[model samples]
Target: MNRRHLRWTVPAVTVFVASVVAIVLFTQVGGSAACAAGGSASYYSAGRNGMCNLGTPAEGLYAAVGRAEYAGGKACGTYLDVTGPNGTVRVQVVDLCPSCPAGKIDLGKGAFARIGALSAGIIPVTYGTTRDPQVGPLQVKLTGGTAYSALTAVLNNHGNPLSTVELQTPSGFAPMRQGEDNTWTAPSGAVTSPVTLRIADMYGHQATVAGLTLGPKDFQPTGTVLYGGPSPSPSDSPSPSTVESSAPSPAPVASAGPSSLPPAPKC
Candidate 1:
């Protein structure tokens, strides 16, 4: 069942109650109209592996965000709809550009080419987190796991920035700690084989995914798509991203000065 119905044309919240697990939905927020600081956009050449370390988004549109916006790894895996001289393209945050200023962004070579002239090197642009994003089903892969022991999970294609991931235990929901790479980890005996995960996004929308076994070489689809709909045309005008407890994600407001900069991400 789809959790977030983007086409509702109104702020929505739906709970997919199930007899299999106790699912509690949090205060759901509306999606972002767009998230941007309105800055110059330049292209970068990485080894193709970004600081977030995700190789590349399947759709291929991706970018390296600056410190003020990255919010440590908080911005990782989130998708942004950027509008430039040519058009709007949705790109995932895959890398970090440490030298870039607060509002500036570094698009992947291909992404930059789509928005502006590559030879131009840089172009003015507006960008923000997208709504009703097009993504594949949620994928959960065990980075490291053993029967009833400690383990780590790499979550993928979870349309929105995740707020939390907890493993179900006999006692209750055992919270999983997010690692630097953005993977979630649980300590020894916190869970057993084929565990269930209670996942929540920043917007507070939650879902329960079960039957995740201890073994899987490739990412296994959970058969759950949080939500999707005709994305409202991303805002073309430059605007400071607006964020609320429950709203579409514009990148978090950037603070002033070098002190406002987040610790440089180790690429």
Candidate 2:
């Protein structure tokens, strides 16, 4: 009696393993965390022209979070929707309120007007991250330094709070350091003209801005918007992907003069 040879297909097994790996990676980096907290809300004008040296505050759409929610610079670009007795308003995190108690937020004049009267001074409010809010393209402002030297940058209009920032240099990608006031500084060797930037947020989403000509006052706009959705579980969604194309245009040079606005009020 002859026994038939048993055969196992290796190609099918290989394909199955690859698919599993891809799915695992995607689940690891595809979603954002949902943040909600209740606290006292107050209004301030200090960030009226924008905080953290990013730019002028978007009237009625900006806020300065306290230590509890600010989480250092991690919460810099995150948006929060605040609800009070009067109504609810959405505001971007532009600055920090050093003295603000936990769960407290300081809204700009415009933002306060939307939710409550400025005369209220302070009011009880509940705030949370906006779910999948529509945002504009990423704006990268070269705040300090010049071409051919160490440089500082501020990224605005990002849908989620950035967790890391990297610059594409002639040699390769270089990591940047986060500084006070929502600023990021490039490493020494990475400071060069006509650079590209790769920015990633806490939600595992990323975008690239190319063709940036480094200068004391240069700015670059990536013609793509970022959309960050609600929190993701380990088994949900796909891996993080780049949101936009690499459109590089000259941005207005930042002024080197001190801020003309008066000091922001403390809580």
Candidate 3:
């Protein structure tokens, strides 16, 4: 072949290859950005606990619950299929963490689980939430006084209940039993100081409240004091019969000590 012709052929092939590579790179970048900016999803473990920050609200909301598993350089868990008012979506635990009050992942309701059974605390799960996780220290609340009382946490998904609750403390993670009044009470005295509560729905989604915090002072040791319950009814509103003029004996509210997990600062 002539020298000029050979040079032209080589340069033409190089340009074509470069163009293809650029197109592929652009597609990959766009996909990644969508996944990262996407709304909330959560990951949880049977025994591990830590926070999963889902960034801001602009991201959609979802929830998921399931046995946590590990996958290609990431954490994963499955949630019960969910069908929300919007539509159906399958969520995978992409980058979230299992916060205290284990077993539940944090996610917006939109991206986790099949919708119908989202209200149940524990349900068969097959999906999970995905997000870049942020793990923080620990927080605790003590209520009733370490005698033998139950513990509870009111989870709000942006001011709504998450349908499930987790009672966590330095001792261990205990699943709270749902009570008649939207309350979750665990077997007495299973938790102590340095407790933190995290919750997720059957669909593997976390509550959307501004914050959910649990501590030693949030539970009691002897009595069946309430931890979390329905919003409130004037009929049951702290009637003198249900409440006492003086605080319970033993650990007074004043002794909870300086909590490390201060109430999550105002949003």
Candidate 4:
């Protein structure tokens, strides 16, 4: 995956507005609309709200999405569009102040990242929801024995039902069998016991299920699985990530004061 790194630092300027009750903080990840597609994940905040550690949430976890970039590389107002509990939100880099480091976005108190489990600073995030952003009615289940649990999902995209569906486990690939109720199931038995899994739309869209402890006892539904199923593995068991989550890794977010600068500059 080609990852682009960019950061915007907005200077705190107190501008008095007649009708405005409060002065709001604004930060923009400097870039053209065309360039907003894919940049390295980072954090942005408005005021001196709360302090967050770096890379607490793993790379493939979920983060709440808030505030949209309307146009002209600026926001009309600070609007937060938080999805479900562990849903994916695509936020644009409007202005950049409260400048945390990479893999972090400081949205102040009203807006936050790690909404669910708060063990780490950062979490993994997908681009969109498991199903369509407007319409999502997908369900995944894990059954069968503990050694090779079967993961299944029913995908309904818009009105068109996809004929062939595929499910992914951490170890390898399995074809999903479409059921009468517009659902699909992956083949049973695999190398690993429980595996991390994901499903794909006809358009090659992928979604993830986080922290699916697929052992004998832990084989049950936990959080919402958007487009993908669950795949549990012993070695690669998903854990919370800080920028330092990967070990021997430099801190993605810098400490405050003199070193509080982004590794990458504004695009």
Candidate 5:
């Protein structure tokens, strides 16, 4: 009887799991025939500068898409019309979200607030591109390079996404490399003064901004029309095919003449 054994019992703990549900919304903008997709939208504060490097975060009209839609810089500078429970807002694809799943758009804080409440955190949205949006005049900005050589620029307010950019040099038309953040870099070569730029969109619509004198600063009020549609009237807008001649030349400015770079070695 002297040997008494003592035993202790522990109570079992309960575990709980939280379920997350995401709703998908879909809608077409401007009565366009383009296909619309349902997706989830969230907001982020990633700073004013984005992958496109065109608009700022303060503008509240920029968005970032998933890697699939980003296509590197291919999706940059493109516009998406997103509609939420509150209203519809058009936003530009300026950045990229590597972790965002397909069919999801991460919008800037300002842009998200326009469509839904900040407290919502995440919301359902329907998004698609609008055909020939009235984006007003084309504004071109020189982001890198000097008037002397190796210029990089970003074309804005063009409504449609640019597919290619060619610079008219003394030698010939040289294609520019579309870089991340909506910047187009000039090929390794001498780009003569009085730069002429020919920009084309995915729809084959082209716009030529002639007579640009590259300087170490920005250029605005370019007075270039965003060319789109078939057979624009001669007085109204120049046709994409014949804009080279019809478009007016930019004002003359001093340049670093005859600057050249070593040719890029063949891979």
Candidate 6:
């Protein structure tokens, strides 16, 4: 064996891989995202209120993420399957714990008990989001909207962290900005009914929920799932809604990256 020849091989391969990652992070538009993180976990059972500002809880299992994972409400409504000493339990990002540091979650009492002992108060945990989780139809809570003010929607029932939320316009689909509470705020436009929304989750799944109506302060439900698993039974929905999946346009780029490349600018 030629030790001298093999000496540079491993380092060369490593450099190539790192360069490729740096290039992709700086250049690519959209790609699959993997959200694995090791962190400490604690339980919170007070307020039931969340930074999400969604009036009703999306589902039973939920948690409050720290500032790092919260990413300015990006983690809101996204389900996380956390594995602890007890087992793995899925939870929604219902709130934010500003005091909680990176890689930490203040899980709900019920959800925390499912994964860890209540007496422990806190425990080490690992958590991440899956690609195509079984999720219910889309629900939108429209509020802070009027003829004078543009409509704000706090979308619910997302299986993954949503990357893009847009509305159909005459010119094209106009993008909306996710507010601090995870509500996507509309641009300066008419908030008309029979509305059409184009959304993309982090896992590269895109779907259109058209023939949908958005009224001010309305918690409307649609018979649609973002992708994967199974469709909710007819009994689950009363609306005549349709969910159509289109070939995703370039998919949502995974914002996760190695702790290199100058660090992602905070949102």
How many clashing pairs does model 3 include?
A: 60
Per-residue lDDT over 142-234 for candidate 1, one digit per residue giving the tens place of the 0 to 100 score: 756565557887676665667788888888888888765666887666445777898877654577889888766556767875554433344
Q: Write the per-residue lDDT of candidate 2 for residues 1-267, one digit (tens) a residue.
A: 111111222345334333321110000111333233355666766522344555434453567776656665777766666676677666666677776655667776766777766665666676665433445578787744454567678887765557788978667778999875778988764455676788876555567787666654534666855443234322211122222222111121112122442221222
TM-score result, candidate 1:
0.68
Of models 1 and 3, which has the larger TM-score? 1
Q: Judge candidate 5 against the unseen true structure and give its global Cα lDDT, from 0 to 1.
A: 0.56
TM-score for each predicted model, relative to the true structure? 0.68, 0.67, 0.25, 0.25, 0.68, 0.68
Query: What's the true lDDT of residue 18 in model 3?
Result: 36
Q: Residue 108 of model 5: what lDDT?
A: 69
Clashing pairs in 2: 26-239, 32-231, 49-56, 49-57, 50-57, 60-111, 217-253
Error of 1 at 226 (Å): 2.0
Q: Candidate 5 on 110-208: residue-level lDDT in tens?
A: 668878777766766767543344444566766445545677877766655567888887777789888656678887655555778988765546788
TM-score of 4: 0.25
lDDT tens digits, residues 84-182, model 4? 235433221223332333222332221234332232223232221121222223323344423446554422211111324554555555566754323
Which one wins by lDDT: 1 or 4? 1
Per-candidate Cα lDDT values, in order, are 0.58, 0.56, 0.28, 0.29, 0.56, 0.58
lDDT of 6 by residue, 1-267 (tens): 110111111334334333321111111112333333455667764243467764323223567776766778887766566777788776656677777655567776766677777776666676654334455677776654457888677777665678899978788898989977778887875667777789987556678888766654555778876765443322311122222121011112133322332332221
Evaluate residue 183 in candidate 3 and report its C-alpha lDDT on the 0 to 100 scale. 40
Would you list the clashing residue pairs of candidate 6? Answer: 30-253, 31-253
What candidate 4 gets wrong by more than 4 Å, as runs, is 1-139, 145-151, 154-165, 169-171, 190-194, 213-267
Clashes of each: 6, 7, 60, 40, 2, 2
RMSD of each: 16.6, 22.3, 21.0, 17.5, 17.1, 15.4
Quote the lDDT for 93 in model 2.
66
